[model samples]
Each structure stands twice: as C-alpha cells, then as structure tokens.
Target: MRLAALPRRPSEPTITLINVVFLMLIFFLVAGQVAAPVDRDIQLIDAAALATRAPDDALAVRSDGTTLWRGEVTTPEAFAAARIADGAEVLRLVPARDLPAQDLLRIANALRMAGAAEVRLVTDRSAP
Candidate 1:
C-alpha cells in the first residue's frame, strides 16, 4: 500500500506583510514627534548652528513685518499682548529669510518688553 503524502503550506502569506507594515506605521507614529505645520510661503533664514527640531510655540514673522500667531495674521502688539497674558516665558521667533535684521531685533525687543524671558530665534540649518 502506498503511503498518503502530507500537505505542504505556502512559504509566505500576504497577511504577514500587511501586519509588518502596520506595526511599522504604529511604531513611527508613536516614536516620532509631531510638530505644528508652518506656512509654505514663509522661508526661514539659514544658520550654521541651529536646533534640529522646531519649537512647539513658534511665532512666524513675514518679510513685510507681518506676524502670524497660531496660524492667524496679527499685529506684533496684539501678539505680544496675548503671549504676555498667557504667561509665555519663551518666545520662538521664526522670521522670513528676507526680513531685515532691524525688524527682527525690533520684534525681539518687543517680545522682551512684553515679558518673555527668553526670545529664541529659529533658523534653518545650513547645508554642509
């Protein structure tokens, strides 16, 4: 009598691949830091040394001296007032690349006067 042959299983299933991809997606979402989105129109100035990550509470300043607070256009005075009222200790300023140094300094000064103990300027890292 001939012996019955055992059934063989497929080497790999599509479900395994899907599961691996899903796990990777979850890992990245949990491990990575989600930063607030910045306006595409605003170009940050380049610096030789700068922080690798963007600050959570960043204020964007346009070349024309316009300021964006929480994604809404606002005057510097208004922004400063709100920030002061909120008791923000650190003010992160992301100014446009074409913004004049005088303008940037003026904003920094205003923020200091508004009660920000530290005014951090955020700049793009220069290419090596």
Candidate 2:
C-alpha cells in the first residue's frame, strides 16, 4: 500500500519582524533630537546659572576668535547679511570656554546690531 506523503509545515512569518523593525525606526526618527553639529576643535563654556530658554539658532565662536555660522567660517558682516527666519528672534552664542570675554561681547554687539532682538549665551550647567 502507498503511504500518504507528510504535509509540509508552513514557513515562519517574517512580516511581523519587518513590521517591528519598521516601527522601531519610525520611533527613533520621531523621538531623537536633531541638533546642529558642533566643531570638534571648539569647547563650550560652563556656567552656574540655569538657562532660561533654548535658542532658536546657534553661532559658535572658537577660542582664537574665529566665528562659525552654521559650521561655516563667517564674518560678522556676512552673518548680519544672512537672512534669518522671520520668526527667529533669539540668537544663541556658543563660545569656547577659553575665549576672551571681550571677544564674546564684540560678537554679541554685532548680533544686536544685526537686528537680533535677543542674544542668549549658551553655557553648560555646572555640575552640582
């Protein structure tokens, strides 16, 4: 007598794994914070005072007094001429920890003259 052939088992579902991985990708894209890349050579200052608010945009100043606007080396005049977002009123200054205070003041003044309503100095909160 001929025996009936055994039925083959169905393949394991892979769609569930694909769905889970897709969901995780979406979650990370949504929850991860996107920040401007800081220059590797620059170092930021630390302050004891808490920041009152976050900055809308950031400008980095190196310890040697070179200014970086959006990661590109820029001058005060060029920075002033650069069109700012219509609703952007606050400009954040990220200066090197060793940068002279006088240079910081000069940059702040230039930004003010450039029509920034507010210039906030970004500093790290000192550890308690």
Candidate 3:
C-alpha cells in the first residue's frame, strides 16, 4: 500500500523583543527618582504652647551641637556673612529638642553678635 504524503507544518516563529523593551522602559519610568523637600537632621524643641510662623531668616541647631543655616551646615561667622548678604534683619533660632542649654546660649550670643536686630525662638505646639 502507498502511504499518503503529509502536509508540512509552519516553522517556529522568532522571539519578539519589542514587548521586553517596552516593559523595561515602563519599569524605569516607575522607579525614577522623586524630588522631595530637603530637611536637615536638626531637631527643634517645641516648648512653646502653640505653633508660630517663622520668618525667612531661621537658624536651626541640631542635638549634636551642629548649627544649620537654612538646612546647610555653617559656622557662626559664615552664617553671619550669609545672613548679611541675604539682607536678613532678624534671626529666628530653633534649637533641637535634646539640645544642650549651653549650646543654645552660645548660638543666641553668636546670632546677636552677627548683626541680627532681634532673635526669636521657635517651638512646636503640643498635641491635644
């Protein structure tokens, strides 16, 4: 008996790389960096009974005895020069919660000598 000829099937298709490239692009877009406000490590003591708005010229002192001028580390002299250049008439001091009393005094004195017309202390309000 003669065997019938069988029909040939189609060859295997090549892999498509377009989907993989698209997925990689989407992954990178979702994992991209997001811009956030820059906050220094300085902690402020909230001794005041209520919260008050601070002026543009604010000096923050960290618990580790480090001084920050607008979220930037700076010495008293440098801070003074910057303040003068920025035309700051008054300086608001925000001391960290665990800041040493002596350090606060030194900062206050330094701010006073830096040509600040007045110095105001800032504190956060306690939760009810």
Best by lDDT: 1
Residue 4 in candidate 3, Cα distance off native in Å: 99
Which residue runs of candidate 2 sit more than 4 Å off their true CA positions? 1-56, 83-86
Report every candidate's CA lDDT: 0.80, 0.76, 0.75
Report the Cα lDDT for residue 117, model 2.
82
Taking the tens digit of each residue's C-alpha lDDT, what string does model 2 give over 69-111? 7668987656655635445677778887899999999998998
Off by over 4 Å in 1: 1-56
Q: Lowest summed lDDT over 10 consecutive residues: which window, candidate 2? A: 47-56
What's the alpha carbon RMSD for model 3?
16.5
For model 3, what is the alpha-carbon lDDT of residue 1? 100
- Candidate 1: Cα lDDT at 85: 79
Where does the lowest 10-residue lDDT sum fall in candidate 1?
47-56
Ranking by lDDT: 1, 2, 3
Tens-digit per-residue lDDT, 92-128, candidate 1: 8999889999999999898888778888888877634
lDDT of 2 at 121: 84
Candidate 3: the clashing residue pairs are 43-96, 46-124
TM-score of 3: 0.51
